[model samples]
Target: MNQHVIRPVRADEWEKVKELRLAALRDPAAPVAFLETEEAAVGRPDAFWQERTEGASHGRSARQFIAEAPDGTWNANVVVLVEEAGTVGIFDEAIDVDQGHLVGVFVRPEQRGSGLTEALFEAALEWSWSLEGPALDRVRLFVHEDNARAAAFYRRFGFEVSGLVVPMPTDPSAKELEYVFPRPAAN
Candidate 1:
């Protein structure tokens, strides 16, 4: 079980965020699990990470959550981006509903099966469904078809295939399947 704290990344933690991301990019699953390459992430400037951290830390539309070990290491992380209905999606398509899109999911190899990823996701979903003004309609994630381990975990976590598929940005011949956790029915 994971006893570590799961919380949003702070504005000043860009270096730690970068470190965790780089480590994640080196994981064996990274090739199919992430859209960006380690080489690309390593080449980004400090300013890019700083700005990205700042935005995620304070922005209303996006947040990055981390599972921090007692020793202060970030063991896992997940980022959620709010897509407003009628807005352009990250893929440049139209977003038909207000929703949260999970991305940049990673868990350190040592933390695998230790419940850290679930803790990270609970924090993310709690944050997502709690957003006010105009509440989100659902939270969705895309998994590479080849990443069966990830997709199976997502199913166990309550996300269901949304019957939509899109070409992976890195390989047009490969596909990414959409899964969603719609806002829980009103209690």
Candidate 2:
């Protein structure tokens, strides 16, 4: 709830980006909230971070945003994966939906209940809706079915389950639920 600023990721801040990602992976909920483990993330070389940030930062459709505290640490982050029309894999790939896939959403525990999540969602979805040409029809995110707290939060934020379940890529036995928020008709 402090005066943290949310903005698109800067091209040169790959180091901070890497640091924040590692920090998120270390969070207690990382098992359910993130796909990559701390070991996997920390093992990546500097080159990976450089390319990752450059690609998303300069991309026409996808983008990453961070909430930075005044002391220069990132309090939270969100990445919007844009799925253009006629594209598959946007929402479960097999379904072929025109939408924006929201992923890699994380907020530090200290910042969890201070409206930061909602603000981050607002920024990510706003960016998704503002895409030109083929407008994104919906915005969606995947949440582990076992993560009840996350599910509750998503529901409060206006996302409803699409009833589409996908196995976790890392652990095929577990299923993750897909939640979606359709773009407002008048918007």
Candidate 3:
């Protein structure tokens, strides 16, 4: 049995981050589950990976959590990006509140059914709700309509359809549905 530990990535772990991201892009569901391609990711310079890892690891506005196997290999990851009101997002949607946008979610095939996904999201959501400045009102993620596995997982995790649809940037004919987990009401 492999012991898996869930935690945030360190800023200096850029090499590992790059390695895991490449692996994710190679997964069969990459087409609909991820926004980047293996070809593009592999072509990126080391500086880009370094900057990306640094920002996500140390930046207050975003964070990346990874599941480390007993042998020290990262087999899964999830990232949350904080968006403030009036900002334009990657998909051209205008942010209407202080929200956390979940993205870059991936888990290795061997680790898929081991509750790793749930652990990763719990960490991401914990960090999002714990942000001190400009408290978040909700957390959101867009799932490709054809990716039923991912959609089912999100639904099982308490995310509900937000009724906002956006055309896939790479394939305008395809659509992605938005799902949201609203913050619980104050006691």
Candidate 4:
């Protein structure tokens, strides 16, 4: 729904955060769209979810945004993690430039094809580019190569493949392709 509010997740909403994640992991496309399974997430201690929510809830290094229905339900979420130049990143690889990596992407099945994903990215990109003290160069995401639907959406959203391939952690034979939203030129 267009009325759905898009905003950053708050520190105190860990329970809601965990709830949405579990739902996301249970989606049929979850296997390719998410790294964690529902079973694994369900077994994690509450503290882990709390700490995770708290960390991303308030920080320049990471931010998680959600689309909340008017009824107070969180139907979708995405996290943008900052990767500073020359620092180690989530991929356990060296970072070449400052950037924002979008991860933990999820949209409720009922909410798909509603333009909600674009709204979420609009918020994320707005935040990413608005950061000061040496702004980031670009925003990027990795999509599983086998997930054709997602890859198509990313392309339609203006994210171009950067020619980088990441080996899947669970199945090295599979791969993830990097896509980036090019930085806007100075106005």
Better of 2 and 3 by TM-score: 3
lDDT of 3 by residue, 32-122 (tens): 9988999999999999999999999966788999999888999999999999999998799989999999999999998888899999999
Best by lDDT: 3
Q: Over the stretch 1-187, how does candidate 1's per-residue lDDT look in tens digits?
A: 5569999999999999999999999999998889899999999999999999998997678999999888898889999999999998655667999999999999988889999888889999999999987899999999999999999999999999998888888898998899999999887
Better model by TM-score: candidate 1 vs candidate 2: 1
Clashes of 2: 1
Candidate 1 ranges with C-alpha deviation above 4 Å: none
Clashes of each: 0, 1, 0, 0
Candidate 4 residues lying further than 4 Å off, grouped into runs, are none
Q: What count of clashes does model 3 give?
A: 0
Task: Between candidates 2 and 4, name the one with more favorable lDDT.
Answer: 4
Ordered list by TM-score, greatest first: 3, 1, 4, 2
What's the TM-score of every candidate structure?
0.97, 0.94, 0.97, 0.97
What TM-score would you give candidate 1 relative to the actual structure? Answer: 0.97
lDDT scores in order: 0.92, 0.86, 0.93, 0.90
> By lDDT, is 1 or 3 better?
3
Whole-model lDDT for model 2 versus the true structure? Answer: 0.86
RMSD of 2: 1.7
TM-score of 4: 0.97
